[model samples]
Every structure is written in C-alpha cells, then in structure tokens.
Target: MLQRVRLAVFLFVLGGFLPSVQADEVWEFVDADGVVHIGNAAPPASRGLVWLSQTPSARGGSGSAKGKEREVSALRLPGYEAAKPHLEAAALSQSLEPALVIAVAAAESAFNVEAVSRKGALGLMQVMPATAERYGVAGRILPDGKHAAMEPKVNAQIGSRYLADLLRMFDGDKELALAAYNAGEGAVLRYGRRIPPYPETQQYVDRVMRFYRALIR
Candidate 1:
C-alpha cells in the first residue's frame, strides 16, 4: 500500500502541476558534459539537466501513465551547474556573494551560456557588443562586427567583474548595484535608489530576488 501511494505521487509531479510540494526535496542531475546539477525541483530540460531520476513524488502536475515525463519533477534548469565554478570564481574575485551571481544567472538566462536577448544583449550576462569589447575581450569582430559570446567562462568572468565595478560605483548598495546590472547604472541613479519604474527593470529585479529567495529557502 505504501509503495502504491508512492508510485501514484510520482506521476503527479512530472506534468508541471506540482509546485509547492517540491520544497525540501533536493534533486541531483548530471549533464552529458559531466556537469552536476542540484535542484529543489528537477530543473529545466532546456538547461540540459534532463538525465536525472526521481526520489518519489508528491501530488501536482499533469499525469501521463507511460512516459519518461511521468516520473521526473517539473524541474527545468538551463545548464547552470556547469558554470558554477567559473561563476563562483568571478563572484569571489569581486567580493560579491556567489549566490547572487547564481540568482542573476538563473534569471538572465537559466544558465544557457549562449543566451542572446531580443535587444542584442549577448552572452550569458546579456552584454551588449560594445560593452563586451570595452572590457578587454580582444577577440576581434568579423567584418560584420560580431564577436563570439558562447564562451561561458569568459562571459561570466566579465559580467561578474562588471557587476563588481557597479557595486563600487554605487557605494556598496547591493540593490542599486543589481539595478544597474540589469537596466544600466543610469537607470538606478535616475530612480533615486529604488528599483527603476520601468516594467522590464522591475521584473528583472523581482526575478533575481525570487531566485535568491528560492536558494535561501
């Protein structure tokens, strides 16, 4: 009877219906490239944490009786674990909290190293090309003036350093530094220390905070 109940609960989580029950459960995943991913939920497939198994399930998510999707939780990570070392390095070098770096990475691209914004923010940090080149990225641009941004380590290195610079500029105010990291330092200054009133900026702040809280809880 106990085993049957466990089996039934397992099916519920795979379908995206179970959100609340994932708390207190830490799932482990390893990618094809030998990256280790740990999550409260299964983490996202697109982020390349898919090949993980389950620890039994609770109620929630959709139900499919006979599929691989039936067992895994609704976890969807974007390859964050692979970059953890580099991200942590950059964070530590900058004297910033590594978790904050992870939070930003989670919000910015779910750890998709090659993520590019619709507005042409490039790389994992979503840096504009002009901004990227200014930071001593000596990789020359093509005739089209485009440079490679898929290098996750380089991207995180520069991004975190840039953020550290922002923190110093903002006088050690994390909120303001974070705001500048997202919407530009100018936006933070204009807002008078509050998150800027722009919808995108506000949403960015909220998302980072959510990830931060998730890590905390």
Candidate 2:
C-alpha cells in the first residue's frame, strides 16, 4: 500500500511533463551564483540547489492509464515518468477526465512534488493537514517536511478525491469547485454559488478553469 501510494503521487505530479520530439525537453534555472544549470536531474555543480524541469516530457501511462478517457501525453513533467498510474487511477476513481486533473496539477504546482506553499502546505497537491484529514488521509508525515503527507500517491488520491468531492458538492460546477479548492467551499456558498467578489478567489477560479478548459479540448 505504501509503495503503491507513493508511485501514484509521482505519476500525477509528473503527468504534466510530456516529452517532445526534436525539442531539448529541458528546464534551465539560474542560481544565486548567476550560473545556469540544465537537465532533469539535480545538478551538483549548482552548489546543492535543486534544478527543476521547466518543461518535461510525459511518460506512457499504465495499462489502466489508457482508458475511455484520453491521456494527455503532452502534459507529463520531466523525469516524473513513475507517476502515470497514480494519475490514471485517481482520475478514473473520481470519474474525472484525467487530462483535466493533470492540467490543474500542472497549473497548481507544475508537477513539483516537493513544492511547499508560503503557508506550510505539503506534498504534490499542496494539501494542508486539516484538509488532508477532512478527506480521510492517513499516515501523513514524511520524515522530510516537504512530503509531510503519508506518501505522494496517498496525497494525490486524497487531494484528487477532495477535489472530486468539491465538484460534487458544488453540483458539478468546476468553477465553484475550484474556488472551494482555493478559498474553501464555505466561501463560495456564502457568495451564493457565484464567484466571490474577492480578487484572489476569483483569480484562482479563473486560472484553474483556464488551464482546465485548454486540456478538455
């Protein structure tokens, strides 16, 4: 269960990095030293600074990955090939379009599994503990604070399931669901199912929908 959960998390996070032919498929970042580092793997020359894959290629999905829903091959992140199965499973489990989930993940965190928010959120989906528990997440404390949730797979499952739950709660309104995901469902309801006038909340909904709609086409 542990291994499965971990792998599932990786696939979902990495699904946005799709490998492209004739393209360098590389991500370059400059460090404090003003030196550029390239490649999908960590560059020791960058003085222990982690090098992120800016535009990674997607990996082939598991047998389950290829289903009635189309896998957005172009969305996978660089070097994150191990996460396809998890993405596929989560998408199928919640009856969501896998590509849409992948797109939202891409927009949210750019497939950075180690990503942490200014607010101490953790794991691939940037879920906080209270939110994690709300979705029945178990064993959520990685030795490293970066992956404080149980495992990447478990985190993705809970996160995606949480999003699916929000979607259902909002009566299949992706906009409301996304707003809830960003600013809590209560905020959306208090605003009468219309997007709240708050700039941040409305922007959050717009961003997710913008990215999501592109993938749906």
Candidate 3:
C-alpha cells in the first residue's frame, strides 16, 4: 500500500515532466492480490501489455522519414513544441514578446502544464489563482471536480497579460517586471520600484532572463 501511494505521488508530482505525446497513455498492473499499480511504463509483471505505441512518430507519423525528422526536431525543449502555439497566442494578445512569455513559463514551471507550486501557483507560467482572477481568467473546474490551471492557453494568456501589465507598471523595465512577477508588484513597489532583495525573486529574474536570451538567440 505504501509502495502504491509512493508511485501515485511520484506520477502526480512528475507527470508534467513526461513528453506531451506520451503523457496520456498511462499503464496499470494488478498484483496477485488485485491491488492495482500504475505508471507511465508497464511493470515487468504485465509484460507485453502496451498502452502506447513504441514508435516516437506514432502520433506525428506520416509514412515518411522526413515526417519523423520533423517530430524529432520539434522537441527542442521538453514541452516547447506542444506549448508554442499557446505561448505565441498569449504573447500576441498582450502585446508581449513570445520569447519573454516562453522564458517566464520555462523558468516558472519548465513548461509543465500540470505544475503546481508550493505557494498555490499553477500551470505553465505558475499563475497564482489571485493573479489569474485579477487578469479576469478564473480557475477552471476539471472533470474530476477540482479547480485546475493546467490548460496551457488559458494559463499562458493570464500569465502573459500579467507580465505585460507588470512591464507597463515598471515602465518597460524587464528586470523589475520579472521580479514583480516572482515576488509580487506590491513587493516591488515596497522596494522602491526595483527588484526586491528576496533571494528567490532575484534568482527567478536571473533564470527567466537567461531563458529569454537563449530563446531570442
């Protein structure tokens, strides 16, 4: 039972790290006692039971080697391809650069749509519920009856709008905007319209800038 619980927690916590193509095909195995175990990969006891195709190109396969090449090339970052359209749309909607939005998302959640921070931040850009609400994007209820921020498009839209607003509030200062995103605009204001001295917020600004530079390059 403990093992099953651990496996469940592991999958729940790290589910976003899995490739989007294979994220949906979960496998399950029943022990001799009928206790079920689940994972992204099949257990040895359930040999030969395939939940997903072995080929990477199965989803994007077009019967040509070039098609396979396209799929491979698309995975420049773990979830970059899957999230690109949404990121672009969100950035455009807010008059923000897609690279800046994508950088913030990558730094916040590593492009994990299912990510939830310890502080109740949610989704790809880790938009807090209050922030999302402030941006007029309310939390969505999943089929499981729980509120979710896992929709890439919605979360990106909210996050990008928030970031853009922060940039405006800080007079187009990317560093101050990014610091506000991490530590709150109120904190930035409290700190004299500058990046706060909080170590975590400072690190977050540095990380997002690094990603932004790499992406724009």
Candidate 4:
C-alpha cells in the first residue's frame, strides 16, 4: 500500500493527470484490499472502494477550474522552472518566444542542465559542440578550464541563437526550423526546405511542437 502511494505521488509529479484535464472528472479511490485507483470514473461501490477525492475538469469554466488549469501549467514540465530564467534571457536576446525555447529544451533533454546526448550534444538544449562553437558558446575557460556547453546559460544562449538562425534560414517556418534543428540544414534543404522524412526528426518536430503549443496555451 505504501509502495502504491509512492507510485501515485510519482505519477502525479510527472503529469499523469494532464490528460484528465480534458475529461469531465476524475476520481481517486482505494478498495477494501488497499489497492488505489485513479481514473475518470469510480469503480463499483459494492467492491468496497471508498472514494478518497474527486476533481472537476481543468477546462477553466469556473474560478476553481481556472485555478486547476494554472496548477496544471505549473506541473506540465518537471524541470522547466529551474531553467526558466536562462530560457527567458536567451529567448529575449534572440527575439524568440520563450515557450518555443522551453519546448526545444524539453524535447532535447527535459531541461536537464547536465544532460549529454549520445551524439555529443550537451546541456538543456542539447547543443552540439560544433554548433556551440559556431554560436560563440565554446572555448570558455571555466574554473576547470573546460568548454562551456555544459553551462545552462551558455547553452541556452547558443541554442536559442542557433534556433533563431534556423528560423530565419527557413523564412520563419517553425516546422522547417525544427526539422533542421533535429536533422541538419543540409537534410532540410535537400528536402526542398520541408521537414525531412527521417522518423526521428519527424517525431522530434512533433514532440517539440506539442510542447510549444501546450506552453503557449
């Protein structure tokens, strides 16, 4: 039972209830055997399932619903708040939307400042070393005299500028820009400035666009 409770808490923190916002309602109950359940509808009362709590839809039809929407937004991205300051700064400096930057970071590394990709991409935005150098984010003499791609602020700045340039290159077409960001500019151009047909790049663009729409909403 304790383990189930812990799992429930973990799911809650991970936005398990995000889809529930579109449902009419949600119920939390525990059966006589101490099994917990959460869903849009409660189980049979004859099963001795005691209702623990209920929440209305998060559609913002009322004051309470609006508050729930706010809560959902706050919980939408787990590590986003920690990277918000740098994201905002980078976005403003690049004349980009902060939500777009956040979406890229989320899709790249889930806002993990220390994340490194298998292809040598690094930090929240997963800027490649060469790309970092192109954006003047490399060759920093840290206390340890290491490159600064691992630094959150530096990575965000470089990645944001890279994205802005992609946007400009693609004539402000976000889908094409995201495709170039995921694949490569050559691939995008080879596809006639359209999104490449690569499955991974397609999926990455979809995920980042979804995150961007959610954040902007």
For candidate 3, what is the TM-score? Answer: 0.64
lDDT of 1: 0.57
Model 4 steric clash pairs: none
Q: Which candidate wins on lDDT?
A: 4
Model 4, runs deviating above 4 Å: 1-78, 144-146
Listed per model in order, the count of residue pairs whose N, CA or C atoms clash below 3 Å is 12, 23, 0, 0
Each prediction's TM-score versus the true structure: 0.61, 0.61, 0.64, 0.66
Per-residue lDDT tens digits for candidate 2, residues 1-217, read: 0000010111112223433332323333322222223344322233222222123234242223332122343244542455556655788888987765665555445455655555555555667677777776643555664344636677677778888988899898888887787777888899998777876666456545544654565
Q: What is the lDDT of residue 186 in candidate 1?
A: 79
What TM-score does structure 2 among the candidates reach?
A: 0.61
Score residue 91 of candidate 1 by CA lDDT: 88
Which prediction has more favorable TM-score, 1 or 4?
4
Q: Model 3 segments beyond 4 Å from truth?
A: 1-75, 146-148
Q: Better model by lDDT, 1 or 2?
A: 1
Q: At residue 47, what lDDT does model 1 achieve?
A: 29
Better model by TM-score, 3 or 4? Answer: 4
Report the C-alpha lDDT of model 3 over 1-217, residue by residue, as the tens digit.
0011113312222122433434433433223222223455433333312131123334354345544343333224456689889999999999899888887876666566666655667777877888877876677687875455557888888888889989999999999999988888999999899888976677568656755755554
